[model samples]
Structures are given as structure tokens and as C-alpha cells.
Target: MLEDLKARNPHIAIYPVSDARFSKYGKVLDGFDFNQCLDIMQTRPIPEEGNCYVASDAELMGTDVAGELSRRFYAGMPVQIGYCNGNSSKLNALEYHKGSEVDVAVTDLVLLLSDIRNISHNELSSESVEAFFLPANTACELYATTLHFAPCKTSSDGYKSIIVLPAGTNAGLDSIPAPKCEEDYLLWMQNKWLIAHAESIPASKGAFVGITGDNIEINY
Candidate 1:
């Protein structure tokens, strides 16, 4: 199965988190008890298709892990703790925040990423994205410049990941601000600027669909 996934997506290179190439953008977080956050995921059910992502749920926000994330990553700025879980096979879209985001893999998963610079004219070319494999119980800080979204499962079972970010990230906006420029159209959620492939659910819901090319999906 793993061999088939690689054969199907020859363009995507999957690297381990320890690879120096990965360190160019983010580092593995150390000294944190990731299980406390992983345990929170078990309290709820994961969606069977695609992913279930909550930006800032109260239960996740209340954990000691949340406080540590805020103190260590945000310089004491309030942070929100959420999770994205379930079976995802596609890189349907990419969204980024003004602040760094920390993702702890409760189960082994795959992350699809693209450099922020590749986003141009409000569009992100699908050709530029890369895939990275994250092992369970490991954590990493994705810089503000990294473009990402939900995790893709590594196997048939699905995945669980704890997402931590600046408070209010991915929250719904009270009202849509009229776009002053091309960039403004990407602001689909509070603190979230997105670019979605035409086939993604976000695009179907009328998010400023700005991606071009195939909505890359992993075979496994």
C-alpha cells in the first residue's frame, strides 16, 4: 500500500521530521508531554471522510498543554488549542495564519505544505506543494510563512493531531470585509487566509477559491 501511494504521487517527496530540510522551516518541539493533548482527542469522535477541524474548542483550550503552548510559543499571548482528526487523502487547500502554529500528531499522519512565497495573484499552484511524514507523539512548530491545512492519514485507519495557534485563529468573522485587494479575498476566517482547490469543500462553500491544478490526494 505504501509503495502504491508513492508510485501514484511521484511528484511528492515524503520526508521524516528529522531531515534537515524540515528544520529549514520548523523544528521538533522538545520537553512537552504531548499525550495530555492527545488524550483530549479520544473524548470525541473523528469524522469518517475528509477531516474534522475545530479552531478553538473550550475543552482543548483548558488543558495545561494549552498554557505551555501559549507561554513557550506566543511569548504569553493567548493561544487557542484545537484538533483536526480523521481520514483525509487530499491536499484540498492550504491556509496560513499571521502567527506560528504547533501541531502534535496524536497518530501518525502526513502534512502537505508549500512555501508562502509560491502564493501569487491570490492563487497557489498545486505543483509546488510537498509532503512530510510525522510520527505519533511528536510535535513541530510551523512558521508563520508555511502554508498548510489538515493532516492526511498515513494508512487506512485515519489520524489525530492537536493544533495550537494564536487565539481566534480560524474563528468565524462577524462580517466579511469588502476586499481592498487580491489578498483580502483570501481572508476566509479570522486570522486565516486560505487558497482552496476548486474541488475542495471550502471552494464549494464559496471560499475565495484560488488554487489551480489537481487537488493532490495520497493513495494510502
Candidate 2:
């Protein structure tokens, strides 16, 4: 599957999550049973047009593994279990949270990732991004400084992935606070800092236009 994806999208390099190149951004997780959660996610519908992101879902969180995730994966930190299902294929934007994020790929997908250190004056060049492939049923943890967004689909079936994060990470903010630094401009929701490409939907909604260069599209 990885080879097929590579052949289909020859213009960009897509490394598997197991590759050393992925270590700096995140690590492939092991030893946690995601069967129940993934089974539930498989039943959720993917949006016909764009992405459907639920920051919190009771059904997913009700799985028996949820308690274990909180105790082990998150070390007792309160967390939320949600899902992002979509047909996205572009590097529309990048977002980071105050804490690490865990993703469980329900289907094969691609992720565009970069380091927060690459940001210069609150702006990041699309050139700094790297593509990584997440095979079906794989789980990985993305560090707090790792910049990421929606998983790009590798097939017409679209993508489905479980999103685990500190509770309230992407919940709406009641009010906007005065900006104290350039990074403040990128704060779009609670614990979520976003940098959007000029052509992205977030940009049209007034998210900080911080991504420059091409809005990369995955041909596969």
C-alpha cells in the first residue's frame, strides 16, 4: 500500500509512520487495544464534500479502552476522544495544541507535518512540510510542537481517524483576548493555535494567514 501511494503521488515524498523521519514529530504507539473504538468509528459517516470534525464524541469515549487511554496514554490527564472523517487532499492549514495529540488511523491516509520551530515570526513556509503515511489501524502520538492538520485521503473512500487530545482543545472560545505576541494571532480556539494558507477556509474565516507558498495537493 505504501509503495502504491508513493507511485501515485510521485511529486511528494511520503514516509511511513515507522520511519526515523517521523520520530522528531511523533512516534508510532504500541500496546493499546483500539479495536472497540475503531469499530465504532467505522460506522460514522464521512462528509460528502469536506471534513467532519467532532472535538468530542460520547460514543467513542464510552469505549472501555477510553479509561485505559486516560490512565496510560495520557497519564491521567483529562482527554477527549473524537474523530475526523473527510475527503481532504490538500495542505490547507496547520494547527498545534498545548499538549500532544494521539491519532488512530481507521483507514490509510497521509499527513502533512512540520515542526513549530520552523515558524519564523508566526509564519511557516509550505516548503517546510513533509508528508507521512499512516496505514490502516495504526496509532501514533504527535508532540505538542508538531504542526499538523486534517489527514489527506489516499483513496476515493476518503479518510477516517480517531483524534485524541486534551479536553477542550478545539472547543470554541467565548471571547477573543488581546494579542500579546504574534503567536496570539494564530489562536483560533481553546488550546488550538492555527496557521492557515491564504486559500483555506480558515483563512476566509479570519485565521492568521501564516502558510506561504503552494497549497500542496496529493495527487493520489
Best by TM-score: 2
Runs in model 2 lying further than 4 Å from the true structure: none
107, model 2: CA deviation in Å?
Answer: 0.5
lDDT of 1: 0.84
Q: Write the per-residue lDDT of candidate 1 for residues 1-220, one digit (tens) a residue.
A: 3445566667687777788878756779996776767777888677777678887878888778778877877889998888888898899999989988999988888888887899888888988887888888889989988999888887888988988888888888998899999889998889999999989888889887888888988766
Candidate 1: worst-modelled 10 consecutive residues by lDDT: 1-10
State every prediction's TM-score relative to the real structure.
0.92, 0.98
* lDDT, residue 12, candidate 1: 80
Question: Which 10 residues in a row give candidate 2 its minimum summed lDDT?
Answer: 4-13
Residue 149 miss distance in model 2 (angstroms)? 0.2
Off by over 4 Å in 1: 1-9
Kindly list the per-residue Cα lDDT of model 2 for residues 57-143, writing each as its tens digit: 999889887888899888998889999999999999999998999999999999999999999998899999999999999999999
Q: Please give the TM-score that candidate 1 achieves against the real structure.
A: 0.92
